[model samples]
Target: MLRYRILKLRGDCLLSLFLLTLIFGLILRIISLCRETFNHEPLSKAPGGDVEPFSLLLIVLGHSRPSSLQRLLNSLSKVEWLHSRVDLRIWIDRGSPRDSLRVAKGFIWSHGSKIVRIRKVHYGLLKSWLQAWPLWDRHDYALILEDDLEIHPQVYQAFRYLTSKIGSRDVDGVIFQRLQDIPCGSFVHFASSWAPVFSRRVFHDFVGWYNARRTCVPGFQPFVPGHDKTYNHWLRERRDVWSPWLRRYLYEKGTVFLYVGSLGMVHNHHERGSHQTEAPAFFVHRKIWPKVEWNRIQECVLQNSPVFECNNTQDGVQCGPVDGDRRALLRRGIKGFLSDKLWICGAPRAV
Candidate 1:
């Protein structure tokens, strides 16, 4: 009888263990589903099934300027056209001061509906960007904006226009604006700092490449042929501490250079005293960052010279047509006329 009782007890214990295992499995599945939903969940809906499924991630550095951020927030609030177009996620550095943290929290809370989350972390900008990478998998497109940006009202319209225009085409990337002084209608295969939109395919591919090749090369070279510009840009900016495999990934398959568009969304705040001293100062006092700064960098790269000059207007330097002949260009063509031919939007008689 005792032996029979022992067998029954063992059977009961086994059944209980099985039930617990089942419950644990269910819990894990639920957690995973919630994570996926949070990451790639549907964005704000529009009528006619045209709503985009993307996340606009605003990654603000801990030491960002308040006035600049406030202006950026104001722009965000006044984005009337894209009322329900994106899911906004703001990632702020948690190691910031209490006051800054409160302000960041306040900003997130105020836009509670659109704001998916306010991730607080203790890291620098580059690290913070990596921290936000997981969220990218959940989004169709991601717009990585910094705190100190002053965007034009039509920024959203411009971004939507580019995305629709560049659908699945293997161009580098699109930027609201660029620092390089390429011809007005130059073709780009990439994007820049302002408000860049990345399809999931592009993001995954580029980041995957970046991961594999970021550290291998000693300084920076094209991960492969035709991609020298992108890799070198990182080298110039002191971010080339990646592996050779990452470099190779970025430069692979004749991905020569990424292209950019000449719309206006991102503007530098160097005049407001936020000069990125960490980066080699390329632009002079009067030139715009995108129009003049990047071109100088490019010139140096082309010449294979570590440092180059903005000597005159001919080589698309800082003193080039954009600056030297703004008024003439404004009167010369319809495109120029439409551009308002100025650095910042709505500036007083700039052209």
Candidate 2:
């Protein structure tokens, strides 16, 4: 009887082991099938098994302070690009320090391609900042950066997201500004050459409008709701200044410059020979992240331009004046940042 009981126990153990093995094999097979069906090609990839990344021109303007320029270039070199290719165009104004020229000319860009433009005559800051990026057929978007500041590693990521999400047609371009009132994210009337991104259409139109306004538009009048004495004075007096006219353009045409770097992407060193001498609390607060929390940036994008020309001014212009309901830019709409037209690579992947 005992022998019979022992044989029964052995049979039961064998039956349990066989069942466990069969279940484990089934799980492995199911997992492999899922991976084969789902993980073949991610939606982020471009077609033809080659990711044709988005292209833009990084027009780096430098004239002096080799250290500042080098720091900025190094920061740019360390940019974490996901699917964007940046072609570098370094424009050195004439009469620049030889050290600065050496730093720019000697630097090697590994990403896409590079072109260094050394002007015959000094273009100065205004012309260098304004005209460094022309209506080049080679590229549609241009990010004009100064050598006085160093950008965060994820600066490209912010630019990528903002360039893709154009909330309104009247958006002049994306700018990297940190406002005093709305610290997180908001649009502004100010055309800050500080770290502004301009599209081909906006820049093309701006060139014509700027020429006309600066030439024909008489008497630098105060345009902002409050006392605009400083800006108006700068427009009239400062010939080498460019941002004043850009501010005028947005003010008159009622366009908005998208501000995504409200949390601070640029660390302005305010080096010698730079325009910005007295760095404000806003500009100095250069808080950068080691690894960018994309979700936080997405929230900031959604929080963009709650009001028209959402600056520190007192106008309180509502976004109703603009084209669409920008507040509808919840997570439900965008799968990811698309092209300026929101067409290419804007849709969801197939189920």
Candidate 3:
């Protein structure tokens, strides 16, 4: 009888162990399913049916103030035209503060935004840009903006007009913001990294040159002190290279960089963020115009001005009038018309 009891006890123990193992495996499977859903779940469907996607890659430092990032995200969300057309991705550098990550998570939850948090190491401005170039593959066009910028409402409209009107091969990219010295509505050969719209082809060519030189490291190019300088150097070096194809595309074909002569499409808030020692002086030129003035500018550029074109020259493409002589007249007319219609003194500063 005792022997029979022992055999029954052993069977019961074995059955219990088997059941526990099955339950543990089921729990693990459930956890894995949850993880897969979180990672691959679709946030929102593309706004329009059967339309291609455009991407806006906003690069932000991990240590940047959350408030600044929040403000920028809020401004971007306000752009109604970007609702369905643009896929927003916030690229956070490695070693970013937890607070910054929290802010990014909030945006992701609220706006159905995507996040790419770099792991292992921090990539400064130069390397960060190179890391982002691959995104062009998934998008029809890509616009790169820093964290401290507030885009104008008409930004998407301007980009669409430029992309369709100016074939991607004829131009390098369109600058959404202009320097204080650059005239409104002028096409220049120089490329500015701040808020520029890039085509896949141009992006490929630019990356090709960088890869050939192997200047992927931040400080490797000793003379290239900053991102703008690096691009300027690339243009100059490519211009000087003996390759006939380079010359033809840059000079002969006049593949010049384009700029909008209307009010700026983005305002540089110059918040004390990454790479800045202190808040830089907020020049009036960098400020975005009020909505009324901005609308007027957009109307003139989209309707009144002719599409700007440039030809490649031996000395590189020269900056010239976008619409021949009418450009100046139009600029004068827009300024005078707006000045008379609205008081310029008390316009609210762009956020």
Total clashes in model 1, counting residue pairs 3 or more apart in sequence or in different chains: 33
lDDT for predicted candidate 1 compared with the true structure: 0.43
Which scores higher on lDDT, 1 or 3? 3
Off by over 4 Å in 2: 1-54, 165-171, 183-185, 215-227, 274-290, 303-305, 308-351
Off by over 4 Å in 1: 1-62, 108-122, 135-137, 165-172, 179-186, 214-250, 253-261, 271-275, 278-351
- Write down the TM-score for model 3: 0.56
TM-scores of the candidates are 0.52, 0.66, 0.56
Of 1 and 3, the candidate ahead on TM-score is 3
Per-residue C-alpha lDDT of model 2 across residues 1-351, encoded as one tens digit per residue: 999999999999999999999999999977754443223222233212333234567889987667777878888888875545567778888888888889998999876567777889988876776687655434556778888777778877666655455433444477675554553456555556566777667776666765654455454332333325545555466545666556544544455556675657776666666465454312323335467676667676554455434433335222223344433322212322221222332232110
Residue-level lDDT for 209 in candidate 2: 63
TM-score of 2: 0.66
Worst 10 residues of 3 by lDDT: 342-351
Instruction: Give residue 203's lDDT in candidate 2 (0 to 100).
Output: 73
> Judged by lDDT, which candidate is best?
2
Comparing 1 with 2 on TM-score, the higher-scoring candidate is 2
Q: Distance (Å) between predicted and true CA of 121, model 1? A: 6.3
Segments of candidate 3 deviating more than 4 angstroms: 1-63, 108-113, 135-137, 168-171, 180-184, 215-255, 280-289, 292-351
Global local distance difference test of model 2: 0.60
Q: Rate the local accuracy (lDDT) of all candidates.
A: 0.43, 0.60, 0.50
TM-score attained by model 1? 0.52
Ranking by TM-score: 2, 3, 1
